[model samples]
Target chain A: AQSVTQPDIHITVSEGASLELRCNYSYGATPYLFWYVQSPGQGLQLLLKYFSGDTLVQGIKGFEAEFKRSQSTFNLRKPSVHWSDAAEYFCAVGRGSNYKLTFGKGTLLTVNP
Target chain B: DVKVTQSSRYLVKRTGEKVFLECVQDMDHENMFWYRQDPGLGLRLIYFSYDVKMKEKGDIPEGYSVSREKKERFSLILESASTNQTSMYLCASSSHDRLIPYEQYFGPGTRLTVT
Candidate 1:
């Protein structure tokens, strides 16, 4: 069974500061990792994904994630976050032919001015 | 761009009442999914359909049923709405093209409150 763990439950970052959200996965095979963001009253929007090739994958809205195979982790990062970047972030691992996803508990990001 | 739409943004339902949640996708996606989001729990898959009229149970599908009568529409049914079922319900669709990894596109979500 594939599983995802997001260590941070909540994080507050000063506006324009760099941000990093930690994610770890447990999967037997090569992992398919994804990052998603959700606003207060909206559904999830895919930020980025990693299937193969390069370890560093770029996503929408100036987001990027690096997949560390040895550590079994895919952590999201942004060089400079804005107030609008405050949202709930989720990390997921996909498996099976249908590409079923197992998601983490999510990290709530709060950006301060 | 792929667009997925759900029936409602918020719904209030009584316990024991049968609840129906509708979802539609515009990109002719072959896969549709239902998931519930709760505080402290990110998302739990309830059901999914790969093709028209074909459904599969997900990790948490005990109290839910689903129907995919057409390729563009997927409906999630709650046999008897309960207080525990009060949560944000999300619908998503993705292509089954083997060349791609099937990244999902989600709807705005419906916050269902069962009283």
Candidate 2:
């Protein structure tokens, strides 16, 4: 079975500061990874996805993720986070032919002024 | 753009009452899923349907049932609502296209409260 682990339960960063959210996955073979963000009382929106090729994948809202095969990690990073970037982020792993995904516990991000 | 819409945004139902959550997708997606989101738990799938009249049990489907009579609509049912089931219900749909098969588009979600 595939599983995702997000070590940080909550993260707080000031505006204009760079941010990185760690995500680790346990899969037997090559895994499809994704990052999703959810604002207060809103549904989840896909931040980015890693399917194949280029280790560095860019996503909407100036977010990017690096798929490191050796470390089994797909961490999300942003050069400078705005106050609007504060939200809950989730990491998910997709395996096999099925379209199902196993998601992590989630990391709540707070952007401080 | 794929759009998924749920029937309700906020629902308050009494315990033991039957609850129905409806979801519809604009795109002709082959898969639709129902999930519950909690504080610590990101999202747990309860049921999913790949096609019309075809349904599959997801990770947590013990207290849930689903119906998919139409290709664009999926319904999740709670036979008897319990306080434990009170949470944010999310509906999502994804295409089976080989090019981009794994991305799921989600609805705004329905917050259900059982009292």
Candidate 3:
């Protein structure tokens, strides 16, 4: 079955440090991948997506993800992190023209000052 | 901005009682979805509608039903509210761009509790 996996259940980083949240997928063909962030008591917000893109895709809130077909991975990264970036992040995968997002368990990011 | 709204922010329902959760989207998106969010399991799709009156069962559709008589409104129904069904319910809508791909705009979510 097609699925998205974020191996890290929790991660902590200094406010200004570089951040990376790993995501891997298992799909039959080229898949559409996405990253969403959810704050406490709020709904999931779209961060970035990759679908036939230029491998590296930029998204809102100073976030970007690299889509590597060989590794079957689309990892989210940020050159610098902010205190506001502390939230739960989810990795999702979809196929075909449909937009059904299959999401991972998510990674809780804690940014320390 | 894409806006999706759920009728209730919090709800308390009794077990074995019929419950309805309403969702509305201002954007004329062709797709609408209902999902339940849990701590470790992430978000599970309950049902989705591609067009008015066109509904499809999602991965976890049992114990839930959906209504889409209108394009902008989708409703999730619980035939008999149960404690197991209590969770954060989310509503989302998206438009087809066929270009850079589309994003599903989510509502604030309704946290439901069953007694």
Please tell me which model should have the higher TM-score, number 1 or number 3: 1
DockQ of each: 0.79, 0.82, 0.68
Residue pairs in steric clash, candidate 1?
none
How displaced is residue B76 in candidate 3, in Å? 0.5
- Give the lowest summed-lDDT range of ten residues in model 2 chain B: B95-104
DockQ sort, best first: 2, 1, 3
lDDT tens digits, residue span A19-91, model 2:
9999999999888899999999999999999989999999999999999999999999999999999999999
Q: What clash pairs does model 3 have?
A: none
The parts of candidate 3 lying over 4 Å away from their true place are B100-102
RMSD of each: 0.8, 0.7, 1.3
Model 2 agreement with the true structure over B11-60: per-residue lDDT tens digits: 99999999999999999999999999999988999998889999989999
Give the local distance difference test score of model 1: 0.94
| CAPRI quality band, candidate 1 | medium
Question: Mind giving the per-residue lDDT tens digits that candidate 1 earns over B16-36?
Answer: 999999999999889899999
Rank the models by lDDT, top first.
2, 1, 3
TM-score for each candidate, following the candidate numbering: 0.98, 0.99, 0.95
